[model samples]
Target: MTLPASAPAIVVEGVRKSFKDTDVLRGVDFDVPRGSIFALLGSNGAGKTTLVRILSTLLAADGGKAAVEGFDVGAQPHKVREVISLTGQFAAVDEILTGRENLVLVARLRHLEHPQQAADQLLGRFGLTDAGARKVATYSGGMRRRLDIAMSLVGEPRVIFLDEPTTGLDPEARLEVWDIVRNLASQGTTVLLTTQYLDEAENLADRIAILHGVRIIANGTLAELKRLLPPATVEYVEKQPSLEDIFLTLVGHGESVKDRS
Candidate 1:
């Protein structure tokens, strides 16, 4: 599918940053198409968080430029902030406030007049309606993570920066969060997610970028990246037919038997 000629949702060009004597990003470059899920993958200390910080206008880059939703992150930080919301690795909700209250607070802070209504809507959307009245401190980790994500959506942002959103959740809870993210993208919200989970990227991202040693080492769609590696086939026998055989039977198959293992 072809994208429009309008500016990309995110554009980073030759961006560089460093702390003390350690360079975290060295002339990085990439673009995220509007209304698509872009995943940035890397190991710990690969500068994923630092790049997020710079794009979210929380930190300045030593050099180069980045624009989020058509607003220069450095020159027009306020404009960038207006169109984007961020959820860091850790949940940022206020523990003392009730889940509903926390959402209301963010809505009010964003100057929404009908904060209560907005908060209630988001609560329902995230399946937190029943727990809305409970204090965040009493909520489970999964609930807190959901609330953190909901808070980020309070202002109806067009671009969202999710920094390792599922860091500490269990498999089921992580899947719950992934469903929420998928719904967001379906509604045309541009998502720039940084994660260490390859499976997470494979499941949710429209395109993936792998960062190593403070630079992007690879970038492409899942199938495109997989094409870079050699193909392998597995053979097994079972009395009950295999799911792969059923799927291939239904979808039709090709005869590219590169290997049988």
Candidate 2:
């Protein structure tokens, strides 16, 4: 779906951040279109998280400017907070609370009308209605993550920042979370995600920006980024199996594993 021709949902212009003697963000900048999924890619300690924190208003920038939904993050933090939701590296759902209870808590906190009904609708939407009454402590990794995102959605945020949302999940669980991200984009919510997995960005991002040395070295669709490189020489190479491939081979889903005699 096409986003409206309005100001970007999030904008960072020459945003800079530093810690003591180390510079974290060196004049980084980007524009995230409204209702689109924008992926920020970087290896560990590459300043992706720092940039995310600055844009989300959790941390202040040393120089430059940032905004969310056209509201300045530093000058109008309350307005920025009103239109954005964030889920960090770890799932924030309470283990002691039932899934339904967890969402209801956020709904009530948001002062939503009829919080319980909202919780039920979200639970059903995420395919967790049957498990809604069960305690989050008993839920699997995927279930807890789903509840965390569901909780974030209680207030109907216009923009959401997901910081490495699939960090430790297995491949199948990761795919499960991917579906939810897709659903958010389809529903017209701007999503800004930072990920270490290149494949995750390839799979989910409508636009991608690669962060390196505290800067955005490249930004474009995957195909546009690829075009910057020399033409590839077509050659065949042996495919090495990743751990997830082995995991899938050993623990098949939606189909029976083939018997290799």
Residue-pair clashes per candidate, as listed?
0, 0
Q: What tens-digit string does per-residue lDDT give for candidate 2 at 1-261?
A: 223568689889999889999999999989999889999987799898888888778999999999888789999988888899999899998999899999999999999989999999999999999999999999999988988998999879999999999999988889999999999999999999999887888889999887877888788887776555434443464333332232223223212112221
Q: lDDT (CA) for every model shown?
A: 0.86, 0.84
What TM-score does candidate 2 get on C-alpha atoms?
0.88
- Ten residues in a row with the worst lDDT in model 2? 252-261
Candidate 1: the clashing residue pairs are none
* Residue range 111-177, candidate 1, lDDT tens digits: 9989999999999999999999999999998899999999999889999999999999999889999
Question: Which pairs of residues have clashing backbones in candidate 2?
Answer: none
- For residue 233, model 1's alpha carbon misses the true position, in angstroms, by 6.2
Cα shift from native, residue 34, model 2 (Å): 1.0
Error of 2 at 227 (Å): 0.6
